[model samples]
Target: MRKIWLTGIAALAMASCTSKTSTPQPTASALAALPTTDWKSFRDTFIEDWFKVSPADAVYQGRHDFDGGLGDWSPAGLKRQGDFLRNAIAKAKTFDAAKLGKQDAFERDYLVTVAAGKLFWLEDADFPHRNPAWYVNAGLDPNVYIARKYADAPTRMRAMVSFLRKIPTAAAQIRANLKTPMPLSYVNFGVAAFNGFGDYYTGDAKKAFADVKSPALQEEFDKAAVAASKAMHDLGAWLEGQRGSATQDFALGADKFSRMIKETERVDVPLATLEAAGQADMKRNQLALVAACAQFAPGASVPACMAKMNANKPANNDPVAEARKQIPELRAFVLKSDVVTIPDQEQALVEESPPYNRQNSAYIDPPGPFEKGIPSVYYISPPDPSWSKVEQAGFIPGKSDLLFTSVHEVMPGHFLQFRHANASPSLFGRLFVGYAFAEGWAHYAEEMMWEAGLHAGDPETHIGQLSNALLRDCRYLSAIGLHAHGMTQEQSRKMFVEQCYQDEGNAKQQSARGTYDPAYLNYTMGKLMIRKLRTDWTATHGGRAGWKAFHDQFLSFGGPPIPLVRKAMLGGDGKAVF
Candidate 1:
């Protein structure tokens, strides 16, 4: 909800560039239409409809046909889209499973899940009306055109211009549709986002197309982009005006929150059980931190040891440079340890995140699934220099903490895990990877790598990894607390500081993120599910040796919810998910 970016997708292309392999070729079976197969026809139309509603999704997915198209965000349009999903679900269920292949059936499950998530947000949760983010942020991927190279500069510029020209219309619909007295958090996020739209539309869009030699296209882009920015500025100012009336009633309530977990992720674990798991993980991390503190500093207080860790910040607080320097060493560590295969020599490019996209301090925008070979941009939003010294300092992470982030964002984390997903043989596996699996695996990688001798069991490194774990655990608690149990923002902020040991600045930011991103509990929730899967799965697959195999196999299913993937991976066993 606060649009916090949790996972960094390392463009595995850079990671995979050394292989000298060309773009993924559509197989004969994949390209040619088998009109007779219920699955193929259904899959084709399903993908078409997805692009039909969210053309930005097409741009991200590398489908250029819909690149310039925009969604109709009016109320009736949303219902039309919802109806399509409902009908699609019923149609998918009507197919006789006995006639479908193993993968086809699994794809059906993925299809249902995808449709359900869309319907839930539109119909159940009422995201379109209640949330400013739903409308103001539509088709607003800052790097969609900048990051991907699906086509030459001129052609892509034309597409971007086409899309930018539609922004005014989108803004008009949003102005008409969005309810006033929007959630305070949503309004604040919208104001910041739209204010940043000026820089993104005017400057970044131009830079992205700077190499374009087409004069006429450039002129069109200039005209379109200018108008788009004006629309955004007006919309943003309008939201600011409404901020006075914006209430803090943002929670999805108990019922919708539960359904969000159950339907979207296919997890039905009760809130109490989830809270217990989060608390257990937080305590475990705290105890580990205590032990690590003792080893790192035998007689120092917790605050003192943390000060030492914080002191390890980069020279002049240049995190971008530090992250760049660590890339090679992290890659080498993974290779030497057999933690997982690197598969290529391409590197993740680290940089300061764009202003509009800095809703979270750090995130990765990897090339979409259809992308062949492009750099995945991992972004860390260092604090604004204008902020107070204390605020700026909170944004600069310690050296060991930075390393764990590198692991989470790149090296054997989101980037590496996605490498396995990118190689999936099925379209469903390639496109439908679930958020829980993606973020969960990245979060889990931090501890898993440490256990595998990363940093040779250094206490500082353990503190960094455990600290991240504790942060995610607090996210789990804060999400359920905020949405289900009526936890106040002040209470959640205190929870972050007291339970997770977050600094005041970070505690404040993370607490607000929970107001909108209730599903963030997925970090710990998904990890626990994966851990359970590993314990049961590895016992029979052969204990230690089974890990690499598990990591590789787990990623191979694309990004499906673990439950769906689990059902297939474990011979239809679903008990482990519950």
Candidate 2:
């Protein structure tokens, strides 16, 4: 749902500045007159340095000064980024956490945590050379300029032209950086993403800017877009040519897998322990699904019960319209139930997914914290046209299922969370949200809404919520299985279908996704952590009366790793995450 590639590295920005001053030593009195360490100033300086290295991220955060800019993904540029992170990690560790104020110390720890995660991907994982999704997801998406109205048409058009003009070079750098003999799944994803970008750049992207009536600027745009499209097409073609040689060596293996979870999410549970947790959740959900089906589908098998639930598709086969109608209902329920605070009246617009970014079925593109008066967009991807009719039909979510999707992507989920995050006093917290924190909260919202009596006791509605939970549980296991235990792609796919009750099209898509995104396990992992935190905190705070207080306090941290938030809330390390 979020920019998976850049989130880790974006905030980890300082390349340690060394000095060569040879002045005389200060007297004790002069030393006493000097100011103490200012954590805020140091943190701000690091963020400013980060903007230069990851300008695309800055642009997303509504820093228009960086509009149309891209990160340097070339070999030297990547090395520079890695150096910056390593130095940032080293620099952050120099500060004595005990000396800093409570909030400052927390922020410092958050910075170190983020930098470590980034270093793992940039250096240890070697994602730039190994995974095409790294490039695809590394804040290269141009949807912001088109979707958000942060500027006049002419101004945004100029930014688009400048951005498009740089794509050819970026595309070449991406192609050169990616080493071949990639996993077949990665290669195919790369092919689809690049070619899809080519399609959008020439088609929808150009049209989005057509309203800009400057002939000179229009000419400039045409030239730039054409070049960008060609570069994208060429890159896609190159990846396609490597299809014959594609390997299945995508697994991170057990040790790296364990380290990945630890470094990225701050979760250090053993693989066996984590897998058992996931398996237990799946079984629990399966049992709940059966109980719901007994009332909803009578004697049908589990698959048949799910089939019956899915058959209640959106009217006229249009999910966008159905989603639009559900927004107010979901929003009202969140308020009525007092599950969480909706910080503002700002509503999310619903639309179909653009060609270039159909990786996830649904995702919310919220405006950055610095931007004002711009609405967030919730995008839903249609089935791939190449799929069979039945598969396409299966891809369309049922009305009940769509309700939870709305809950997850908007309403009291991501959009509401962002509203609180945007108000964060910390710039780093406002601008950068970790994957586990963001997705975990959203996934947790689905069940939270159900527990708060959304469509209370209705079998169909309960099925929708449980189905979503089952999907995440499968992801939790599949991620550990695929990356740590050498589970085959086919095995992962079967688990999605049989265990999660996902449709054929979704099962295949989800399994292939595990190859490039082993961290997709964060959804369920995050949810479990959050649930535990809520239970632990509310038990002492005010029992059920503290639900709203818990929700508000939880979202106020913006999006750090869950373990960090857990520690903050529980007043200790809160060692067990799952």
Candidate 3:
């Protein structure tokens, strides 16, 4: 549930500016006279503007300042936000980052990056109009349900009612602002999602809203649900009417895509280099998959072995409990085997995927430092009772796959990495780092755990891990190719099926996902960067150091770009923390 906002390179560009006056340097006394309050004020304004534009983010951070409110997607709202960020960026450059303390300087740098990214998107990318997934109601989007956690039952119902009332206005703005094609497609998806929401409310609201069984409450809930349903349907109908005429390309051209990579991952590599790396990793994973298959079934070829393994998927039965049972065993194996330091404060709790989030198989909900007593929920989606056994089997993790997924989502992965981020010295750093780092580290952890022999007892576990890696690497290729290199959906699907060995259904779903989320490339790309970073650092620092020591040191600095990591760790001056 970590909402890592995307920071653009423009922010860093603002921070990197230096005055070029030929005047004599100021005296030490004069330099010291510059008030720290000025920089603090700048930081405060940036944070304030950030929260205003991203209220869902504030709610997630346990700040309910805008609990009942939603984002303003109107053209006027977008212009206002853009103007605010531009003004903030101009103000930010006046403060000297070097004169501030490390933490304050990091905050200033982050604020600049955030503002720059926002401005870039608004002015250059024109994402609000071009991306279909921008408004889709998906499990990955935390905005719709954030208020549910903060409010009581009646209050939650009221919030939903209020949210529903605004949906038409928001939809109108979306339609006005968006390019013809993408919004229609997105609205189709959004309508489909809203259908599921209606079902969820019908099933769960009875008990939850018991105290509100009066005619008034029922009427309000009914009206809201009906309005939501109608709006979604109407949107979908409108989208269908324009199907043949829709003409917005979702691609983020090479320059913008490259900039995104540089700003988000701090990598200087070109798209070609990333593609080559991903291809090589995919080949390596294929070889590993073959090797693993040979161990599992000596006479079977890799494809045959994978077919057998897929056919032998476990039956769905209390998936959450079954998944939970594997965690302690996996945790113990990881710790005893010296894979990575499992923090003492770690607490992994298994929970059913919220009815709203059932589409995703599972997700790690890591608690922030501010949420100390709150348990980290490893949300597992249980099979719908309506599903046939065969249909259900596809999602139920077999014992080996269960352990592998647990290790990736919980132990020594997301839960652990986030705990470290939460413990960071710079609150702004904890608050502002991008999703590439968080997701990339978790994906990276999956491979690192396998390398450390955490999957030793079961070769199938190794194969499962490799299969997952292949799918992710393929995702990297598909995301970059589709969004940046003009790759077609058919091409991406072929890549997934042929290289990643994914089933046709899953491959198709993933290809559709790419149209909206170009950053899906981050999982594999980020992980590869982290692994390469670790290898280079280890070679420089000697291989004798414990993995725990290396890992602790690496994560001690809040999740900065990998390039910045070198400066953070090696630049002992402590001023390069961000």
Candidate 4:
């Protein structure tokens, strides 16, 4: 959850520059006097600062500039970064956007938006010091796997050693910043992950470090390994101190939550409105699920139908291998359907999720620049080998349910849309849009795929997709309820299990996740907004447009809010800017 930073003054100024310019006017004195070169310089500097603040983010994005440097989450460091962002914002405001070219204007708009968002977080939210997951999850371990694919083995090992060495300092900052009513659930999860990670290193360290002939490197790796063990120990001890005292109430209160909706998502709807919309969607999806279930198992109840569907799922010697086998077919379906345009260079690889990165079942690894041909990974969590079949079944995607998660996480979803985004010409488009739109587009894409007849041959498949939709709709409602309506975790879990028909264990995990990720609401909210935008766009264009054209145009602007999409497509300014 890295914050986007920039100011409104800069946006307004840049917008003014982009207003209906008649001619190129290359020789104009105003353009000549503008700080165009300075703006590009500033943009690079800002990106560098951004990489410095979140080095793990850089590695994830395939930037090896800060390979060995871990991010500092200390309060002093956060304040320093905040101060830097504020100063950058102030400097950005001084630029005379009225005299700049189109590219410069776009850059200014993006910088301002990013800077303002950062300043808002620094001043209004306790997020910097209060969230322990931010630090715990932002580690070098996950990136090591990705980076190792590209870097030499020894260089990769050295980077790992350097990263492990910083754990003590990183863990100390986390301990120092522990707020009242600590995020104990997240702490417990983090401790579990750290403990698992320590075991991974301890068992594999010698092999990973075997080729390093230098004694200095060997000693450094040993020292770092010891430090990491200590850090994990300290973290567990600190987590134990706040066990029963963790806050059960997950509300962000109305004002702050609303601000999040507006600033991060650029959604104009109130939280209550979003909640109402989610409930309606929940009901609609529930009905659809019931209808699909009845079609699959005539006259059976929803649960009975689900049991039948689950019963018929493919048995496997390796559940993870079976899941992996399904991915290529899904990707092929999305590509052949032409629902969304995917990059020619984008590599969609499936990898097992590391223990440290397994809070969720799957996530899309970020891509690098299109020119360099960076690959996107669809990370699937392998079932624990020691778990019973019953325990393992909870994670293994049922055959009928496989495409739903596939569409959401991979093709015609995050991976597909992000490839387009990374290749976007607008640097601001490349950097500054919100995750709500990004995640929302993916969620929307999943539903849209079904609507386009993805699983028309199988009623059970449709039921599974609808059930997943119900789950997300419930997430939207639960997120709003927990953060805007003061719903307790128990209450949230109950709502999910009862209405969403999620298993008890899954319900509990989702509820706990919502405490830290309130913006989970965006999946449904964004999808609904995208649907509305599509309908409006279709109606205005005589409903004659092809889905490919519509979807391509929609995604081409990167992941701006649906409202911004409407403005870009229908405002008739003819600029076609994102």
Candidate 5:
């Protein structure tokens, strides 16, 4: 139930000099310098202020100088951060995009969206004070210092100790800031995760950093960790008490939800349009699934067919190892098929996800765009041993499912797309990676690889790809349904089982996820956006044969909202996104 937030200006302090041509320029665009240089002054003051409010994120992003400090959740501190965002947004308006180059204009647009997104969260939604989940997700991880190896063991251990020391203050702020009569789902999530994290901090997390040999540092860590664990335990105890009294009133509502979509993603489409699109995708994938099921086994029930497919899962049911086995081959497929360029020389290392980071079964942990020469992590969390046998079975995906996930996480998906991003001359390209663009390209890459004959269009391969597609489709429907249409968790869970063919365990997990992460809908929504953009851009540029050309062009801009990317790619933004 973590909120998706990245609160910083695009790239203000890094670039000090704007590039200008000496020769006679074609127009104002040719004469115009990269606005990044001019905007550099804003980033310096902004980032310093930002780090003060969100030090853990700064350290997580490899800004080790901001090490050891926890975020300020007190009223005065919150107001200071809010005012900082307002001023940054106001300053961003002064950049005259009319005289700037195409790249500069795009950068300007992106920076505005980033500012607007931050403002929307702080002022509009006011999530910090309202949502209790923020308190948990924000301070829930004292183990990040152990998780990331940006520095040596001793240094990281010290940072961990400092973070641990700050936990009591952070927990006190959480107690003070949270409003009562909390949403049942949010309270339940906080109770489970916060309590579970307290256990992790006391045991597994301590084990992770136990290798640091300095006895003095160890003594400091022991004391700090004890205090941090108690803080979490106390926070969890309070939340557990509230859970019984919590009610189901978690929707972002229509206006704020609509504004959320617009300000964060630049998708101005109506809710009905989004729901209709999702329903259509669900039906489309269902038909494809039916056909694939038919091809796999003639006239079998969907469940029976799925059971047969599920039984074809990994030998030991270890997706992490299976992912490691398949990724090199997936890369070979990319080169053979020539779908998109693979600029990533480094491969994503597969491993178990950290204890604090195991909300989903699997995820790719990419380095921040400013980070280079660092290996990307593709973390696969196995089913908790506490789960029942049937539940554990549901956690294990079929081999083909793992293959598509590998394609999405590595090779020509996130990892490869990011390599092109890092190569971008625009700092905006590197820094301002949007959720829509990143998830869209990764999602699009799944089907694109299949279209390029990943398994020669085999039926099982189709089943795997379509199953993932349907899951995303269900997410799209459930997001709209739960938030905009008043759909209950039970109803959303039923939709997953009925339409997406998800297992009981997965259905519950996904349904509960939509309660907190409405933006999970972006998987299908973003994939479709990329598909439409590709079809339109490729038609005029070259036809289907220009797949690689379209992909290279699309990924070259790094991650901006699809609308801005569309405006850049198509020469103008239109009313109809699709």
Candidate 6:
């Protein structure tokens, strides 16, 4: 699961220069002072400037100076964000590469790449107008105040009140910005998320901060919460009303989809080539699943075989409890296997997902790099109660399947990757983790754990890991097919069931997810690139013996696009990132 703070459209390196107007420009003096010796200070200032516009990001990064703030989401605000990125990109390109050292040059490229990625979404894609998820995930989230223990209860409560008070305006801005006749799946997502926020504000959010002892604050919180809840519910109702005109126009088309990969992930492979890679991986995982099924459930079909594994659901069907038990063992295994360095002893807590943010089955909410001693939270979402009992049951992961998920979200996956990221020397790298790099590493860790002898020779465990791989493979193809090849959601869902062997419920969820999250293909793409890099790097760096060193070095770059890391690692153009 992605971090709450980092999961939104606007969360990806929001802005570089602070811009008060729609068309911000670098000062002539600023541009004239080019190629200065203080690259580090410039980078640091960029981050500080970014926080002024994207305060929520700062709050999550453990910078309390911007604790109660949210990004401006009005039309003017959106234009300023885009303008800021454009100005920042221009300034970044002005620095002389020859004057900057190799590391500084690399950092310059990294910042430019980040700013470009953000620009693509803000200006090129026009997500703020076309996608409600941009607002829902970016501005509407209050998880930081509720979950992180960065401050005392009273302080956090105060921040929460400040946040809630702003939501009425944020809600209006979101409703105004989202043009109508949206994709059906997108409309539903917006409806559910907005309504969920309404429910959460008056329920869990209120309770979480109940211990704060101040009548004045309590009165303020109550008034703010009521308005916020009403605003959310009204927004949800408005989105639901859009169901009458909802269309199936969710595709980014081939061109923008193609650019999405290059700009955001730094991957320039042809879409057909990318599709072929996913298809080949799908076949590989399918064959492995067949062999594993033969061993685990003789004479049964693939679906039945998966059902058998999934039948052994978590104890009491409580994934949160099961996840807790799994993590300690997973941590111990990673240590014993010596696959990667843990960097620190910080542990992650397992929790049930909050109602407003249960879009993903599970995700790890790690503390930002600037934070210290704060535990990460691994949240597992229970099935929606509206579903039929069987569908709900199908939503719960089987014990073996949950184990690999544990491996993905905690242990040697997101949790450990973040621990290494927190130790990074480069602040830019620590702050601007690319989507593909983060998800890809977590997904790759699942397979790596299995290869490292996690439940070695156990067919069920192997099936568990392969289940996830096949799911990602299907996502890779589904994203391409849905967005670029004119595939319908039903077609994608059926493919998930028949080819990926997903349950009906999961297939539905995964298929719908592709429309909104086209770049989700990164799970497989990132894993493949990382695996290829490992083979090439380990060939000379002690082969299999270099696993820990490779992991440590790879993570040291924080979370740049994998290609950038590949170049840094292999010391060439790194054009062969595949």
- What lDDT tens digits, residue by residue, belong to model 2 across residues 455-568? 978999999999899999988899999998989999999999998999999999999999998889989988998998999999999998999999999999988888888898
lDDT of each: 0.74, 0.83, 0.61, 0.64, 0.73, 0.82
- Give candidate 6's total backbone clashes: 1
* Model 5 misplaced regions, further than 4 Å: 1-37, 43-48, 135-144, 384-387, 574-576
* Best-first order by lDDT: 2, 6, 1, 5, 4, 3
In candidate 4, what are the lDDT values of residues 1-578, reduced to their tens digit?
Answer: 11111111101011110111111111222211223248877776666566565666555445554555666667656765566667677777777777777557546655665665555555555665665555544553645433335555566666677667677777787778767666656666656666666655654654666776888877877877777867866776767767778756446778887777665555656555777788888888888888888778999878778767656655663435655677677767777776667666455666676666566666766544322444666776665555566656665656666567767777677777777776666665665556666777878887787877776657887876876787788788887887778788888889877888775556766787787777777778778877877776778664734667778788876655555566666664222111
- Give the higher-TM-score candidate: 1 or 6: 6
Query: Which candidate leads in lDDT?
Result: 2
- Report the C-alpha lDDT of model 3 over 1-578, residue by residue, as the tens digit: 23233431111011111111111212223212223357765565456555556544544454433343446777766766677767776777776768877666666656666566566666676767765345542112333233234444555566555555555665676567767655333444444454444445444543456566467866786776566556645655655666666543667878888876654455667678778888898988999888888889889977677666666554445667777777888778777877566657567888776564444457766543443355677887766455566545554655566666677778777778777776676655565555566667778878877777775647777877887788788888988888788888778888887888776555655676666666778778778767766775677676735566678777766566555565555553322111
Task: Please tell me which model should have the higher lDDT, number 2 or number 3.
Answer: 2
What is residue 509's positional error in candidate 5, in angstroms? 0.7
The alpha-carbon lDDT assigned to residue 203 of candidate 1 equals: 88
Residue 10 lDDT in model 1? 17
Q: Residue 212, candidate 6: how far off, in angstroms?
A: 1.5
| Superposition error at 452 for model 3 (Å) | 2.2
Name the weakest run of 10 consecutive residues (lDDT summed) in model 1: 13-22
TM-score for each model: 0.91, 0.94, 0.82, 0.85, 0.91, 0.95
Please identify model 1 stretches exceeding 4 Å from their true place: 1-37, 136-138, 576-578
Clashes of each: 6, 0, 1, 8, 1, 1
